[model samples]
Target: MSMPGLSTGTIAARLNRMPITRLHFRMIVALSLIFLFELGDLNTFSYATPGLIKYWNLSVSSVGVIVSASFFGMFLGAWLGGWFSDLVGRRKALIWSTAFYSIMSLVNAFTTDTTELATVRFLTGIGMQAMSVTGLTYISEMFPKDVRGRYLPESPRWLEIKGRSQEAEKILNDLETEVETYLGRSLPEMRDFEPVQQSAKVPVAELFSKELRKRTIVLSLAWIFVILGFYGFSAWVPTLLVQHGYSVVKSLNYSFIISLGAVPGALLAWPITDRFGRKQSLFVIMFIVAFCVIMYGLAFNETTVIIFGFLTAMLLQTQTALLYSYSPEIFPTRIRSVGTGFTGGLGRLGNVAGGLLVAAIFNAFGYAAVFIYVAAAFLMGGFLIGIFGERTAKRALETISK
Candidate 1:
């Protein structure tokens, strides 16, 4: 039997109607496993820094260098990765990035000197951002049009803009077939949305056109501050606990307790985001994080410290969920990867500054100074997004970009 041709809207409708199955479960599980390894490597320095200090008899300046090194690489990686994803393919970009970072991380674990470690970490950082940005772009590109439904959509705009209509239609048909196979029935007919016009060619400079310039700038600054706040505080949380008069082992244990909060925060963010909209919800979350950080700095009791610390971690993770979903929507499909990469790369400068700033303050002042700096970053991030970020809830990606 010949399969009937369908429109992008029909493909999206079929995908949205899919029921839970082992195939979906497997895909989610695979991504989760990859994320676990990546996150562990990303956070390794946070746990290792104190021990590295003792083992290497390191100075605060050296610690700052080690921490900032990866971010420098990340800056390069994100931009290049974005370009690569556009030029080649998302899957290849993701695979190459994953392999590069994973290998570098393993090499870094055995390094005996700060110089060697920093060098390896820099390379690893490149892979980290590349893998992350490529993966995110892939997810956005792979899905069907979200329309009024909760599921995210595939960029028909992107497909049309790139002159890939046939491929796009094929994807929709394949998805419809899969859903039909699962349901053991045919899908209901759907009216096709008018396909977007295809440009002869799209220049990268389209990202900076008058229509998009303001959005580009706002997202860039927002990302910078968000990364600054996250890396500044979380990277040093264990070390901060140690400075607060706890043993190193106890500090690690306390950090673990704080880490547990991230789970619930992530679980809660998805559903709640639709109600408040991305811009407003991010503002509230960041506001709460700043307040929690301030309280964490002032709290002298262990119980008080743990409570506020947990809240801060949870809120920060939630902010992360919102930020990622929000950021990519601001750009059209043609430059989506590059736009995301550019902002993410620009934001990574905050990570570089954050590490050095934390070291300087901790050396000259104390833990309180570091918290103040991080709190300020979070506050600024919130303000920028709340004031200028687009409301992306329940909107199509193509429409949002325009």
Candidate 2:
């Protein structure tokens, strides 16, 4: 179980070696902060929309446009970001992406019409996902394959033809170069057979053989639940708080409180996931989140509102922390990004639903119903994770992929 060459500094140096470090915790902190700011800033659009409606004479459809702009950009960004980050170093891609969103957020403040908002939001989304996903891949490489951390949630590139755009090919090339130079293996030595697809699923069954399929499915389900919890909470909580009779100020304050709590969850999740185990950590988080989300909806006092508001983040956001780390752990480096990207990007379907569906539930069924729905999603996530998820704490990364 014990290897002779692993050292803390070695890991740290690997993680922070400009493009990729072995265990660059500081870079993770830096990346997390940039992401938190972007998420916080992006959510502001929801609050900003009404004011924009009056000022710009925007239509109801325009509201939909503003919200969806970010998503459309994000899906594309996931592919491009992974390609870009893999092609360039994670650091430069991140620096540029952070600056892109920072500029776009300010531009969003000045939008005079729906088109402008959509344009700005789309660009902002590009920047946001590009930075976030690249950071995810970057962080994953730095840590030991067996180690994982709280993803505090999130995807890559392909289908384009340019040298810079061809990430999958580039990655294959990188693997070839790294192997030939370091280990004296040719490209043929590292090539894997393409597994047959069964519908839209990963055909993880074929890729790794039947024995591993059960564990792979469990890992996939864990990702789905984590995302569902994150989206379900973020989407419904504000309206639910309003339905519970809180003032606009109270609702806004509480939303900010929960988001702020996510900051610490993001910072610590990676270390916790790596040290403890992804399944065990997520199990703990899901219960805390389920309990708090229930209390946030049902409790009426000001103090209880604030306490549970912060408490809500204990796990809902922690879903993100674990997801980023765990998903990649389940695949090989060649297909790791593809595997993780598939889940993270497809999961955006849930995110899009989160923005619209929960609003409908509140509009039609009331806050209590929404609370019940969110609670069910979280509890189900906990149950699914406990039952289906794999333990990636100290296992090798290549093993997960196989």
lDDT winner: 1
Q: Pick the TM-score winner.
A: 1
lDDT (Cα atoms) of all candidates against the true structure: 0.75, 0.57
**Candidate 2: stretches off by over 4 Å:** 1-26, 46-65, 83-103, 145-225, 239-245, 267-271
lDDT string, candidate 2, 1-402, tens digits: 121121111222222222222224555577768866877775676555444555677643455556666666765566566556545455576677778878877887787667777888888777777777767766665443444353211111111211232343344334335444654433222121222111222232343456545645565555455555565666445545654676656777777777677667666675677678877787777877888878877876778777787767655556667766666666544444444554565455345555565656766777666666777777777777777777677664434444
lDDT of 2 at 135: 70
For candidate 1, write residues 19-63 as lDDT tens digits.
544444554565556667878987778888778776788876788
Measured on C-alpha atoms, candidate 1 has an lDDT of 0.75
Weakest ten-residue segment in model 2 by summed lDDT: 152-161
Query: Per model, how many backbone clashes are there?
Result: 6, 24
In the predicted model 1, the residue pairs found to clash are: 143-154, 144-153, 144-154, 145-153, 145-154, 146-153
Error of 1 at 287 (Å): 0.4
